[model samples]
Target: MLATCLAQGTSGSPTVRVMSRDTQALLDTGSVVTLLRPVLAGGKAGEPMEVACVHGGTRTYDTCHVVIRTPHGVFTAQAGIVPNLPVPLLIGRDCPIFRPNKVWHVDGYDKLKPFGIAISGCIDGYSRRLMWLSSDSTNNNPAVIARYYLQCVSNCGVVPARLRTDCGTENGDMAAIQCSLREDHTDEFAGPLSHMYGTSTANQRIESWWSIFRKQRTQFWMDLFSDLRDRHYFNGTHEHKCLVWYVLLGIFQKELDEHRELWNNHTIRPVRQSLCPSGKPETMYHLPHRFGGRDCGFQVDPQVLQEFKDLLPPTNSLCGDDNLQYFANLERQSQLAPPINWPAAVDNYLTLKEMAGL
Candidate 1:
C-alpha cells in the first residue's frame, strides 16, 4: 500500500540534489505512480546492465521511489531505514565509530525577525541523532539554552563526555557542558568538557546541520509570521499573545521533528567519500549492541536536571545569570505560595469586622 511521503520527493516539486548519487532527482510528491521495471543500465543490446531497479513497489505508490544499491549503503528515496530487509549494500565496517557517550553538539538556530522566536537542538556527535528540539523567545540567553539542554540530557539517559558550541551565551552553562571560552585570562582544565570550547570551525558538526536546516526550511517563516501579524490576532488581548506563542512553538516544533526524523533515518551521505562511513546514524547508535558492543558507560541522573533548571532565569523573566538568583527566588516563592481564593478571603474579612466591637 502507498504511504504518503511527508518529507521526501513530491510531484511537480523542485529539483533537489540527491546526496547519495550527486544527481538531481524529480521530487515526485506522488502525483504519478510508477512501478520499478528491472532493466539494463543503458540502451545497448547484449550488454550487461551496470545498474538495476530495486524491483519493489506497492499498489498505493502514486510516484516512483528512487532505489539503488551501492557498496557503502543501500538507499531508498523515502526517508527511513529498514534494517531487517535484505539489501545488497552494506558498509563494510561501522562508519565513524563512536565511543557512544562521548560527545554532543548543541546549537540555537534561526531567530525569526518578525516573532523573534528560534529553534535549538542537541545532536549526538557520534550517532548524529537529534536528541532534542525546542522553540524559545529569548533563545540567545543561557536560561533558554539550559532548559533545552536539561530536557535533552533528561531524555538521552546519559551525560556526554563533552559538549561543543560556538561561544554563544545561549548554549547555557552546560551542567556538564563544555565551556567555549575562558575569562580573566586564566586557563581552565583542558579536559573533554573544556576541550569543546574551541573555534567555530571546531563545531562543524552542528554548524553544518544548521546550514542544511536553513536551506531545507525557514524560507516559509516570513510569510507565515506576516500572515499572523496582519490579522491582528496577536494584538487583541494578553490571552491572544500567549495562545499565539504556544501555537507557533507547536508548529515550529512539529516541522523540526519531521526534518530531524528524515535526517536521522536516512543514510548519511558525506560530501566527500572519506568524511564518514556510508550508513544511517541511528544504525550506528543502536546496532552495535548485537555485535559485542560495549554497553554505554555514562548515565544521567534525573535529579541533576532540576539543578540546571534552577540555574535558568524564570521562564517568564528575562534575566541574565547575574540576576538569575533573585528571579529564581521569586519563582520559587510563587510556586510555594498557595493560590488565594479572593472571594472567600473577602467574606472572612467581612465576618471578622462584624465580630469586632465596631
Candidate 2:
C-alpha cells in the first residue's frame, strides 16, 4: 500500500498528494514568497508570476494555493510553482505562520582576545545594514552593550521596531531599555516584546554577516595575533595583554571603522533564492523604498533618548588606568611618538615591554 494519501479533486482535475513523513519543507525567512513543486500542487499550473532568482535574474512560474497542515494548526498558503524545487515545500516570511515583526540583531565577537579585544555589533534585519560595529576590551558587559545600542539609535534618530539578541546576561540592560522605550506603544511587538531573546544560531542576519566579516576582515587580525604569539612576543600575561590593548586598540578600531565603511558601500550580489534586496547596504538602509522595502524604524524623541542615556553606566577604558598611565610615562621618557601604523605600534610595544621589564 502507498504510504501517502491521494485525494481526488473535481472532475477532470489532477489528484493532489498529501504531504508524507518523507516530505521536506524549508522555512526561509529571507524569502518573500512561499513555493511548492508542481507535483505537490496537483500537477496543475495557475496564473503566471515573475520571480527573482539567485543569479540576479528573473523567472516566470505558476502560482497556486496549497493546504499546509502542521502540528500547530492547518492553514492555506499561496505559493509559486517551481518545477525544479529541491524541496516539496518552501515557506517564506510573508506566510501567516510568521509574526510580522521587524528587528535588529545584536551580538558580540570574542574571537579577538588575549590581545584584549572584543567586538559588539548590531545590524538592521530589513536591510542587513551594520548599525554599529565597536571594538573594545570587553563587550559582554550589559552597560557597555546598552550604550552601543543607544548610541546607534541616537545617531540614526530612530529605533528599530524590535531588538533581537541571544539569551545572555550581557543583553539585560539592552532588553530593559528596549522595553522601556516601547512601553507606551500599541504594536504587537511593543513593550516587553520589543526585545526578543533567542540562541545566537537563530539570529540569522547578524550571524550570516559574521561569516562575511571573518572572511573579509577578522581573519587578518587573527593571523597577526597568532603570529605574535608564535614569536613569543605576546606571553599572555595580564600586564602584557594590557600593553597590547593599550597599543593596538585605537588601530584596531580604526580598521573596524574602515571595514564598516567598505561593507556598507559595497554592492551585494543577488541570490536566486533570497527575497531580500541586493544593493549597497547604505542605500538600502536609508532608502528602502527604492527596493520595495519599507522603513521599519520608529522615531524616538531626542529628549527621551537623552533621558535613557543618562541612566547608563559610565563608559569604561579599554585597559586599566594604571597600565595606560604607565605606558604614557614610558613613551614620554623614551621620547617615542605614539604609533601611527602597525610597524610603529610594534616598535613601541617592544620598547615599552623592555622598559617595563616584561
lDDT tens string, model 2, 1-358? 0000111111211122334323456544435566777777753345666765432457777777566665334556556787777556665544444322257889898788767888999877656678899988888789899989888988988777778788899999989988888888876557886777766755656766788899998998888888988998888888888888888888888988998998889998765433456788899888877776567667889898889889888877756688899989998999998788777888888899999998
Q: Locate the minimum summed-lDDT window of 10 residues in model 2.
A: 1-10
TM-score of each model, paired residue for residue:
0.50, 0.76
Q: In order, what lDDT does every prediction score?
A: 0.44, 0.72
Q: Which stretches of candidate 1 lie over 4 Å from their true place?
A: 1-97, 111-113, 175-195, 199-202, 226-247, 270-272, 289-297, 317-358
lDDT of 2 at 315: 72
Count of clashes, each model: 8, 3
Instruction: TM-score for candidate 1, please give it.
Output: 0.50
lDDT of 1 by residue, 255-317 (tens): 777787888888876432122234676775666454334423256556755665775666662
Highest TM-score, which number?
2
Compare the candidates by lDDT and give the number of the best one: 2
